[model samples]
Each structure stands twice: as C-alpha cells, then as structure tokens.
Target: MVFFGKKSPITGKQNARKTTGLKAASTRSIINKYHQLNKRKLQLQGLKKRMKKAEEQAKEAEIDAEITQIDSEMEKLGGLEVYQKASLKGQDQTRGGDSSHVLLKWLKNEGNELALEEGQEKKLLEVGCLSVSNAVSKSTEFDTIDRIDLRSNDPLIKQQDFLKRPLPKSDQEKYHVISLSLVLNFVPVTADRGKMLQLTTKFLHPQGLLFFVLPKACVENSRYLDGELFDSIMASLGYEKLEETTTDKLIYQLWRCRQEKAKYQKFTKNEVRSGSTRNNFCITL
Candidate 1:
C-alpha cells in the first residue's frame, strides 16, 4: 500500500531564509578577500627573509618569482582595508578639531600677516581630501578650492591618484595655499613621501602657505623622520616655518614658501654632517 504525506506549511519560508543566508555569505567573502591578501603579503615578507639566508642563487630566484606573483595578485585586489583602518584611526586622534575648524582658526589669527589682497579670490589645493568637508571649502576666505582623492566617488572631489598622475602644467604655482592632512603617513616608503612633498611644492605660489597636519607618531616613530629632521627637510625645500602647534596626537605647522626655485632634497647623512645653519636644529638620529 502507498501512503501520501502532507506537505510542510513552512517550505516557502525555509527557501526564503536559505536565499538570505547565501547573500550574506557572499558579501562576507568579498570583505575577507582584503584580509587574505594582507596575510599573503606577510608570508611574502617571510619568504624574502628566507631568500636572503639561502646560499643558492636558484633558490633565491624561485622566491623572487613567488614574491612577484603574490604582489601582482595583491595589486589586482586593489587597496586593502587594513590601510584604511590605520588612516581613519589617525584621523580620529587628530586633536585640533576637524580640518575646517583648524584652518578657520589659523586664518582668524594669522590672515593679516599673509598680506592677501582684500576681496581677492584666493585659490586652495587640498591633497588626499577624502571628502569635500575641508576647511578651505567651508570657509568664505577662499573663492576656489580643489579637493583631490583616489577613493571618493563624489563628483565634487577629483577622483585621481595624486602620486600617479601629474597636475596640469597651467596649475603649477597657481595656488595661494595647499593643505595636506594626515596624508604623508599613508605612504609606505620614505622616498615616496619625499616625492609627494616635491609634487606639493609645484602646486604652490612662491610665497604661498602650506598647512600640514600629521600624526604625532610620524615624528616619533617613523624611520624616515622626526620633528627636527622634518624641519630641516622643509628648509631644504625652501619652506620657512611660520607657525607650529602640537598635541599629544597630532602636529600642525604653517610653512611659507621662500623661493620658487627651491627643489625637494632628500635628507642624508652627508647633509647632516654639513651642519645646518638654521637655529635650534638638532637631529636625534
């Protein structure tokens, strides 16, 4: 004899729940790609150390090929979330308030010294401006401000990589002010940071001001720079420090370009040995 069983009333609801679970799992897998890429990078670093210890050229060559493959894969995956986390953490710790507030305060206190023409339209360029909420954009002191970033999709922000592309020749030395807030520390290499600074110098007028904000740890722990070393490097780049303020978390400085001809020079042991004529200068390293 054949028997017939009743259909479960919750069959449709069970199917819907399965569909939702699959979608959530897919989304999580995409996010986990970044974490996986980071792990692979660390593994590559270990391989490099092993390659150094290897006495055979063939073994070292094999490791090098492996590293190249991993790096290419990582590049295809795009920017990692770990870098974004570090940048956001540094931004949160910045003490003098938001970028807009600090800029406004500086203008209120030091605008007269700038000798800017009354009612003239001032130009400002803000690099690594992840959003349009910059001080120059918010304040009435400037008529034109360009905010550039790589990750933002907002139409107001220029979606371009500052390091990879060159600014228009016509824009060179056209800005009256340039602001760099928590941008330098993201550069993985010291040479790259110097390159960024050189690019910044091109965008400012001869007497224009640079408003720089950086994490305090950059000066304290970075292999490339400290407070005094940074100041010397700026001097070599023709920037004269006009004002500086510091907090436990961040350092803010206003520097005026002394000459248009000054170029970026990397700090070196020989340069230190030459002795800095600038007063109150000392290199801890």
Candidate 2:
C-alpha cells in the first residue's frame, strides 16, 4: 500500500503571510478606532450646541463631561492624526485642512504688503510643512520658498530636526517671511514652545513677518496664557502683532520681528485673564 506523507499545514511562507495579514488588520483597527472617536466627538459637539440652544443646563453639563472624556481619550491616543499613515491611503487627496486654507488666503491677500521691491525676490521659510503643495501653489509670487519637516519624505522638503541643529549661515536671518502652522503644539512644554519661538526669530529678518497658527486650546486651556497675555509674551519676544484671528478651532496671528527686548518685564501666576472671550484682533498694514 502506497501512503503519501501527511503535508504540514504551516510552511514558512504561509506563516509570513499570516503575520502580514495580522499586521494589516491591526492597522485597520487602529484607523477605525481613530475615526470612531472623531465621529463621536463631532456628535457630542452637535449635542452640546442643541443643548445650549434649548437652555438645558443639566443636559449641557452631561454633554460637556462626555466631551471632556473624549478629549482625554484622544490625548492618550496621541491626538487626531495617530493613524495618519494608514488613513492617508484612503483619505481624499484634495481636501486640505482648515488652517491650510487660511494660510493660502493670507498669502494671497497679504503677500504684496511685505516691504520688498516689485521685482525683488522674497525669501520665505516654512517649518513643519507636510505636503505643502497647496501652499506652494499659492506662493507663486515668492522668489524663493524653503520648506522643512522632520517626518516628511518629499524630495522638496528638507528633513531636519528644527530643535537640534543650527541653520546654515546663508539661511540665518535671511528669510523675509516664516510660516509656522500648528508647529508649536507639538512641543509639549510651554518653555520649549517659547524657545521654539526664539529660534524662529533667528531665521527672520529684522522686520520680517511670522505667520503663526496654533490650536485655540493653547489659550483657553492654559492658566498662563490669555489673549492679552499672549500678546504681551509676543511683544516681549520682539514680535509686534500685526494681525490675529481666533476661531473655534485655531488661532492665526501675523507678527513682525522688531529684534528688540521684551517690553513686558514680568509674568505673574495671578495675571490670568478672567473671562473666556475669544479675541480677533487685526490691523491693516
């Protein structure tokens, strides 16, 4: 009787395939969790709005608690972009975030206001510029634009740790405009954020402009910073606030570097502003 040896069910190739499948599933699960949390957060926001409109104080309090819980969970998971790598494959390529649109509009409306000769090249430095194709497209008026990011792989983006290294001599205080969109929030410490601001000034000309974008939470959630306090801090750093806009989600400000010492001498713990009124200060250049 001829008997065929029993074939093993698990070969090396099969095991490798199984591992790959498991990894892909894990990635999908993470992405799904992120989206679910995001969707729930939006829903809670709507509920909060309706509760406020109806003047249901009790219901509004409950919804506020739920929203706070969600925010805590999101913070644990490393913010809304935790699964960005996995979701990028399926996300709409055309949709730029709200901040990008704001930056584009600012560029279009204010690009010419910079004191440069009509034909002179304006040097611009953009930090944390992940996939700045939209910003670049809107910046055709600029003579030269340099973009840098720590994580981006785009050939046009210089991959460098902005906090660790000094800029080349040729680039020091050479840029006429520097744009930093949602970059400060990544620095976890408040002092480090201030340090980052200081470093940014090193790359800007004496009267150059810094277009800054940050999450509105920075002002609302911090006991140390309010609208007026933030303005004072900027002034102390030699930045004169040219314009500012505060929305529900983000804060946009345009400041010109004066290369002067901080005019505000003290920062007291008791100096917190009382109310939570959103400030939208703007000036015509």
Candidate 1 vs. truth: CA RMSD? Answer: 14.3
Where does model 1 exceed 4 Å of error? 1-96, 111-120, 171-173, 222-224, 260-266, 269-285
Q: State the TM-score for model 2.
A: 0.59
Writing each residue's lDDT as its tens digit, candidate 1 over 1-285 gives: 111121321111111111122333333343244434444455455555655443743465554565565454444433443233333333332323465557667766754245355555688887777556544566688778888776654688787777876665773336788888777654544456677777677777667888888767556555445677888778878888887888776788888887754655656532322223322112221
Output the number of the TM-score-best candidate.
1
lDDT per residue as tens, model 2, 178-281: 88876776553345567677777788866788889876766766545667777877777788877778776578888888877645354444435445553322
lDDT of 2 at 214: 75
RMSD of each: 14.3, 16.6
Error of 1 at 63 (Å): 5.8
lDDT of 1 at 138: 64
TM-score of 1: 0.63
